[model samples]
Target chain A: MSPEATAPPLDESWVPIRVHGDAGGLEVDWCHLGPERFTAPFFDQTVEDRLRHPFALLFQHRTSIDALVERQRIRPGLPVRGLVFHMSRCGSTLLAQLLAALPRHVVLSEAGPVDTVLRAHRELPGLTDAQRITWLQAVVAALGQRRHPDEEAVFLKLDAWHALELPLFQRAFPGVPWVFLYREPLEVMASHARHRGAHMLPGALGLAPREAAGMPTTSLDEYGARMLARICEAGLRAFQHRRDAPARLVDFTQLHASAADLLPELFDLKLTADERQHLREVAGRDAKNPVLPFEENRDEKARGLTPEARAQTERHLRSAYERLEAERQGR
Target chain B: MSREAFERFRARVLEDPTLQSALQATPDLATFLVLAQRLSAEQGCALTESDLRDALDAARRTWRERWI
Candidate 1:
């Protein structure tokens, strides 16, 4: 493909990269590659491009943490100590907003480059471990550039799919502390049904063919379980395989109930009286935002999993939650 | 660290006071060095290895006492 043809249309911010894989299946447009090339193995003109043409708008927004890190304007010598991983539609957004309200942290929400990297990895078969490491390095570099030299800590909230890339992130930022947020599976499914429609539900979660059509299917409940399992698994496995290296689990319910009381202790930061007060007020006001409203339409809820089929989902989640508690207690 | 490097680091760190306090209280050279090296690498820029190494040493000592 010629540079122009391979290149996304000038106005387009994301160009689809075809992915061939076994578990996720071979597919076109599985992931996106940015126009800007930072490293050799990850992005190149022959396969990709460097800044020869004016930067084609590759993403709608500059939320790519990697791109921000490349800007090199971020202050140095700050203590960025937190990463938040979550299951979709849990209260993660609210938690992130609460954390961002703190005076001492900069929270980057659901940045795109990480997702792009994961998609590329999954789709493009035969990527060597070294190549994978280099891609991850590129992502870390992107995040580093986005740090403001003046900010002491940077907190990143990633999409749930990022859970699959936890091992890579653990290697990239070895010692950084992290927390995973999860809600009850039924609630998560209900919220996802309400917001993402049929698009986000994974197929193996017992989705019907019509419901699964045109949707990205992964083992949602199974993957969610594995993500929790990785976090709770003891020692270096938790550190090496879990995305939130030095990980902790925060129940969505608990976070909603006691965020103000818990955050300072967990993050090792002292919030000023005013900051604490502000956080409480924000939490209280947002509590009514309806985290997982029940869907009155049975058809909507039934799209992915039949009532009978969903029993397995419940069993999986319960097992995962139990394992997480066990891991958290150092069992 | 050079004045320029320090300033860049300072600006990002100071964006949040809690981080500022943590850095000020700790002032570990190793942590700063690691961060600086990582930042430079990410930006596709280069820094003198000696400078990064010095900062890393300082940060490690400080973090051991404070965080670890």
Candidate 2:
């Protein structure tokens, strides 16, 4: 048989490289990954690593995506295996990295292009819910292109802030399973106190009129506490309103255990004993700092919170934290 | 503009708080290009809106080429 006989047919539409700009206007940075690029063991690489492949030919121009559907003949993405939403500093990345280690899975851990459109939903106030949903579907379709024929599922670990936009995403892909990962509030805050993510910093997300109206103070710790609580609240609301979609709340404590047991069932993934072992090994390292060995530091993390930050967490985050814990315990 | 000219202009903008604010406050590409043109000129780098667009394109290419 000719090699062409077995090769997957190429769809000529460009893979969107990233989204740029705000609500008043939006632009998609598009690229075409040349034939043979996806045929390699590209699934093993990180999203950024795959994106950086030299075989990609990027368009110099940006498009408004007004003609996105007409211009791109996108293959419907592999049945989305699961979506991972989180409170920042949780073990969500570890979960994604473990899933990515599975031979048949394509995991995009916080891919920048995906985050771009989600953030644009807020930055561009003119974008209606319907439009954002359409744009999100297109973005996922572009990102979830099966790089290798063996790939069976694609998982997305969204930026933490995505919890706030849960309803919109649910509207976009209602059939996909979703999970929310969270750790206790003080531990999460303490981790941030050591080194803050851009989202946790004040003014990163320009406040909405509703949020701006209710804020009691704009101090760093207060802002962090309020933002973290809102993220937790959003997760709780989504899980409560899951309706028919498969959704679960995963505590940081349950993560390692779930790697072997619950996660596969949740995502409809089938893992061999060997594959499960490989996943267990991956979980033993720092998911973000994969070069280093993993260490258990929960006690250390709890101790790191100062009295002021601890008091702030207790004041602003206690109810949300208790609520998440209750749901995780199946209460 | 050459890559060097764009780099110089970008550096000057970063160093000046007012220019940074102007860039941050820019609502869209049209405004950004106008600001870039003015800043480039103040730094003696001959720049036009077209040149600024080319510079952005060049930067993207440079980022991709680094992977190659």
Candidate 3:
């Protein structure tokens, strides 16, 4: 037998959910996500919801990266409408949720398969950049497959950590409009302090080249601040690199006030009256958990923030934050 | 529950989009299993509900244990 196994050619009924193993040993886990739109807050939530389906459970398929790539050759998926990069806790979730509310849009919020392919370089030594951009493109294209006749556009809200891999993502989908959404440094830090993301930990994601320089990040607060700084700097660097790149900076400070108009204008999306009504309803609920009502907690977070953490955030993120603000305003 | 019988039925399903579409277009599992078993027997490969249940249960187990 060959070193790898080939899976069945993807039909419209089956979609890949995860990419397992490394370059030498690779496998793709698939489930029937067809006939079901991803309206949940996150990709996993959508997958979890489908767990109760007989089709999803009974007809699981496993394949190699080759099959994913092959499917792309046979049939391409919808062209991307936008790519969203965020500094976590920003209005990124809100943006994704709003997009999902529209019956004509397919929103993939922080999908795992995309992250795995983007980080393929980390699994193999001596590789400076992504080892499998082809797989990345294929997986994304596969997910963007139109399951509903009304599906008109696809939007991907990448993870906060993906800000570091901006160039790599840009390379995969050139000419696609992208946005970098951020909030006040202090507010974002406080939110993470309460319920931290794994990216906030030192070397949790196998230290990027920047953190590997021996910065000696000791505490969770410092680590989180430094990581935030890296994301800010990376976003700024990408913006300055390509002045003509279709990139926008979304502060999301007054997200509720500005998003209704800002989003469609920035992405050049035309919304119908029904879609507008749907957006209003979606915006009324928690973007991350639709079960709860939406509430703005910036004031609460500021009040709860420790003086020490605020100082640490300033020490690390002050310059980057100011530069980002300047760029957002200047543009 | 012969493996050969199920394999034959699966092969025909893969080759026939119309059959696959009919199966996918079924409204519910009870209806789907009835259609699937009937089609399996029509293709000169009879597969009982027990056979499909065992196969799908095994597939579900493998999928649940898949690495995310």
Candidate 4:
């Protein structure tokens, strides 16, 4: 064979490339590559080249997560100042979008990559403490890319499932502040059922069709009660674990009434006069709909819980809410 | 979905400098579906038909921009 032919496809000229993985999977793009075939070395070089560069890695392995955490811990660049936690559909989107519109802050809204990373390591039996730390580290690294040092902060609106993983985040970026948002339990249940679809399993409000089909169907009341219980439990757990952390609990009702006053106070963010005005405009628009339109169907819909189920959900939520409030007040 | 099919589809789209430029400019739903349709046809796959249809529906619902 001719030497030219044998020498491997002359490492296709360095060109920017975007590699898309499967749906709901990681997507990465790079500016350029040197003359090297797609090999291990090429991947290593790509990683190095993209250092301090942001790339979304969906379903990142625990090992990868560990490397990212270590990098941030040892050589921390900018602290991830903003993190938002919530039960799904609790006005998180509005808050995140508002924050995103502000200058000097990069907001990753419902980032698919975050979900992928959590799902990747969640199934494993028992990752060591160090391994678990790394998983969170990778997430921070992926979410923490800043083009300029002056870019005030990086904000991440975490996946609902990540409520269970708050401790990991706290351990990774201890300096970062977090906020948790909640709505009335009945309203939350109704909105979740209407928008996300119902599920039979515990804590499974937004199960996809495939996921729902995999589990045995239960009574709508039972499903609603279970979902509410799980959400309350998750919230309480997150609250208890991060008692000392800078956190705020914004009731959905209060947020709807006056987000302008609540949001700036919660985050301690200093907005310019124009920024504050812009925030008021956005908040006013969002606050107009205090009750989610779908709440009316809670009684008539298939996912509507029976009176007994409703009572159970309310009972659990009341206990959880009291505990959360007490913890917040340092009781 | 196969490697060969993916490579072929990529090549076909990249071959057209205009489409490639459009794709580079905006990787939004419209461009993605157009690229997917072209690739699916080149791959001799039936899956592309549904993909294109869904993409059209999504674009109409979200962006309200018709492709054809």
- Measured against the native two-chain assembly using Cα atoms, what DockQ does each of the candidate structures obtain, in the order listed? 0.01, 0.03, 0.24, 0.06
lDDT tens digits by residue: candidate 2, A1-331: 0011121222433456656654457666555443322212122233234334321321222455654443435467666778999998888878777777775676777666677667665577666788777777777776676666677777888888888889987888787899998888888998998998666766555555236324766567777887888889999999988876899898888885556566687676777898878777887888777777778887788899889888889999888989999987888
Pairwise TM-score winner, candidates 3 and 4: 3
For model 4 chain A, give the 10-residue run with minimal summed lDDT.
Answer: A1-10
Best model per lDDT: 3
Model 1 residue A293 lDDT score: 35
Candidate 1 vs candidate 4: which has greater DockQ?
A: 4
Cα interface RMSD of each candidate? 18.6, 13.9, 4.0, 13.6
A191-307 in candidate 1: lDDT tens per residue? 553454222444432335333332322555443333333333322234335543456677666776677777776666677898888887666644324244322333454465546
Per-residue lDDT, model 4, residue A287, is 26
DockQ, candidate 4, vs. native dimer: 0.06
RMSD of each: 17.7, 11.9, 4.0, 11.3
Model 2 TM-score, 2 decimals: 0.74
Candidate 1 has an lDDT of 0.46
C-alpha TM-scores of all predictions: 0.51, 0.74, 0.83, 0.59
Q: Which digits, one per residue and each the tens of the lDDT, describe model 4 over residues A1-331?
A: 0011111111122121222233333232222222222211122233334321211110011122223444445444345777888766567766776676565765655554455445443334454555655555554454444544345576777766566667777776675778887766666665554555323344443344234333343555445445444555666776666655787766666666766667777778887888888777766553214233313332354255446656655755556666666665678
Give the clashing residue pairs of candidate 2, or none. A23-A124
Worst 10 residues of 3 chain A by lDDT: A1-10
The digit string of per-residue lDDT tens for model 4 on B13-54 reads: 433545444444443545555555664565574235454454
